[model samples]
Target: MKTAEGLKDIIKPENLVYRKSSLITDKPFSYCPGCGHGTTHRIIAEVIEEENLAENTIGVCPVGCSVLMYDFLDLDIQQAAHGRAPAVATAIKRLMPEKFVFTYQGDGDLAAIGTSETIHACNRGENILIVFINNGIYGMTGGQMAPTTLEGMKSSTSPYGRDVKMMGNPLKMTELVAMLPGTCYVTRQSVHTPAAVRKAKKAIKKAVGYQKKGMGTCFIEIVSNCPSGWKMTPVESNKWMEENMFAYYKPGDLKVPAESDADAENKNEQ
Candidate 1:
């Protein structure tokens, strides 16, 4: 067996593969054991730290599971009324154009009551990042059905499973926003697996870069798992999300800037 000092030599900076972002507070996450909120928070913090935007970034969050986001992120965080995050984010960005502004919202808050605000924000082409977490149900305020809830999915309000005819089809908010002219980038991603996390992180970084360039609104929808709300093990929720949620809300970019615009931006940067 190696002594403690001998082990330290093997665990030098050269062997360091990963480290927690300083932007993330040391407080333990309040999310459920299998919830995806923790992973999403970590990546967002990492992105801000990696870009050296900790002091210049401001995040807006509304009611729902992410209501306590201010406790985890070490930055200027604004709390908006339930389902009003987009409006608040727009105001903040307009007031402080030099600062990086983003809204972190859940599906129920973003797609239901705040639907008009979200649509108008994108339509107006606000230069902000919208980080949307879609877990189908209201995770924090009981497992209630949300606008993005998959058809036939069970929730506290829809005990017998969602009825499409009665409750209407699940809304594809991401797809809806992608069609708006104000949005420059729109993508749907997940963080259920290691590879998925990598892709999601890249997507976030790209959105931040676009926001920095004032390229309209950049929206990223993270299809997350709500184990406690879904009444399943974390592993089971991931599997169900893959089989059901992915089928309806397919992943990948829904919108991107035209080639000419992208080329022009790239050249300008150079």
Candidate 2:
């Protein structure tokens, strides 16, 4: 009888102490088993919940695999045209200044077709956040070549490998965005490991916090894995990201509100 009681105690819901998952793991995610989008989505959802910004948060999802993010995130979400998420987010934040507005974009949407929109939005110092996923290829568009495709990486369009002389090097979106003075916060993070995941969550939280504080543009470029496009298993894709991608796109905060004397002086003058 004592053993039976103990077993019942172990299985009790109160004894289990179940905390609501910041992530909605029960919902069927559209992403493949090894896709990094699922991890990114979970982190974003957790950050929103942890910060208690669900009511005032608004998300703009681009026309890519990330477009389905609206369905997964239990927040007010708007769908943007291909590569126009930044523009959409800018308008939303401008009209509803009190609300927190963010745009989720993929490499193909942000780096290629939306290049002009992304640059102008950052240049204008829009009070919004951008979560950019750099997965090398256009996963939603049948794995076509993206501007961020590394030199010599093969894609549907680049069957013989990307030729640097013709294709140019992969676009480093984070570095480019960080160069703009209007961009207050910019970082490159990954979801390949637990440590990296923690760092990414921190970066995401900081980005949203900056927006909430009425700071200008905040951009987070996440180097994500796409097993289906990369032709590697989930484990192999994680390994590949750590080895090759991390070196090229080293993860860290590339830009933030200036603390240096020169920056202070510039801000003072402005």
Candidate 3:
């Protein structure tokens, strides 16, 4: 076996192809082991680092599992009241137009109580990124049913599964936002696998780049898994999400800017 010093030269910077983002904190994540939140955080940090926005980026997080993100990312973070992240992010971006602003929200907060805030911000065409995580149930509050919970999905509150007749249908928030004219880009993605993570990271980078061009609202819904809330092992939760969550919240771009508009603008300039 090679000694520690003998291995140091082999692990030189020239040979390094991968490493954790410097924007990420040394503090361990409060999220549970195997949770997707950790991966999501890592990818976001990587995007900011790659874009060289570590000093200029601002993140807004509200209550629930999403709130702890401030501790994990070294960038400037502003905490908002539960379900009010979008509104807070709107103010930040408007006040500091030079800063890259984004909101990190969960389904329970964005699709339910903050529905108005989320809608208004997107409708007003806030030039900021909105990162929504949909775990179906309220992960931070004892697995209660959320507005995005699948029809017939069982939760602590919906012990027998959700009933569309009484409980109402699960809200496709991403699909709803895609129809809004103020939004320039919208998509649903997951981070359970390496390929999916790569796609998600790319989507995030694109959203950030759009802000520089003053594009309208950019939204990305991460169909994440909550093993603790779902009462399943991490592996089991991922499998279930693939079969059920993706069926309804299918992963793909829901909306993107029209090429004709860009073409017309270029023609006008010429």
Ranking by TM-score: 1, 3, 2
Candidate 1 TM-score, true structure as reference: 0.95
* For model 2, the run of ten residues with the poorest summed lDDT: 261-270
State the C-alpha lDDT per candidate: 0.93, 0.87, 0.91
Put down candidate 1 lDDT per residue, 15-118, tens digits, no spaces: 88899898889899999997889999999999999989999999999999899999999999999998899899999999999999999999999999899999
Give TM-scores for every candidate, taking all chains together and pairing residue i with residue i. 0.95, 0.89, 0.93
Q: Model 2 clash tally?
A: 0
Candidate 1 backbone overlaps, count: 0
- Error in Å for residue 236 of model 1: 1.1
lDDT of 2 at 47: 87
lDDT tens readout by residue for model 2, 21-94: 45454568899778889888888888888888889999999888978886677888999998999999988998
On TM-score, the candidate that comes out on top is 1
Best by lDDT: 1
| Residue-level error in angstroms, candidate 1, position 174 | 0.4
**lDDT for position 155 in model 1:** 96
